[model samples]
Target: MTTLEPAAVADLVRNTLAAHKSLFLATAGSTGPWVGGVYFAESGEFTLNLVLEDRGRTLAAIRENPVVSVVVSTGSPMQPFLQAQALAEILGRDEDARARELLVTKVPEAAPFLAAPVTAVRLSIRKWRATDIANGVLPGAELPSPRLP
Candidate 1:
């Protein structure tokens, strides 16, 4: 089996996430785990910023449990992958305008939702597991988690 250093993978993940516009977010609701595709704007520290419906299941889940998982694949599934479990902070309406501006800048289709009542959620990446899919191994197989402050 091939092995990768956590720090190297972590840097690669940061760069890759910065290049991608969307990610797959996984959250748990009362029923069970649910996944959604969301377009996001990243913070300089790699935190993910996105606007979510205030009454949506993801908001409910975040309110109930602030830990969420995310997966971002570069270019294609066969490329490098970055997976992490992050801390979710549900932002108040006061932050909506800035969040909406950031999101709409990347995904223009989200402008309509910004007109509606929505809450912005920021996912602060804690640790990541990475893999290179070209080698046919699980992206985040058994590498040490690269934690962020």
Candidate 2:
């Protein structure tokens, strides 16, 4: 099995968060079911911003069970493609002001949404893993192989 170095994984995670402005957040619903929602994410040292409608199901689920998982795909349908999935054990309660600031940075178009009544959930990523399928796993480095004869 191919595995990336910690540093490499961290870099990849950072870049993926930066590249993809939005992420799919998955949480357990009140009825013991799984639910997913799209939200604009703002990456941080160990946490990410999940901005959503204040009275939406996503917010309700988070309120019930703070734990959540987020998927940041490469937006490629190809199999074994590079992707970063993070499992975050959310901490504390929603912070509207901070969430608005981060939302503005990540999604300027979301300014209106941020201005409106919304909930900002902070996700503290406890464990996360990233894989580079196209390029072989390396330690803190990404290099494309040159064509050979």
Clashing pairs in 2: none
**Candidate 1 on 1-149: residue-level lDDT in tens?**
45566565657667677777888889997868888887888765457799777788888888888889988875476787778788889877677667778888877887787878778888888766777767654635533334565
Candidate 2 residue lDDT tens string, 1-149? 45666566667667767777666677776766565645566556356776666677777777787777666665553312222233433334446566667778777877877666666666666545554556654222332212211
For each of the candidates, the C-alpha root-mean-square deviation to the true structure, in angstroms, is 3.2, 8.4
lDDT of each: 0.75, 0.59
Best by TM-score: 1
Question: How much lDDT does candidate 2 score?
Answer: 0.59
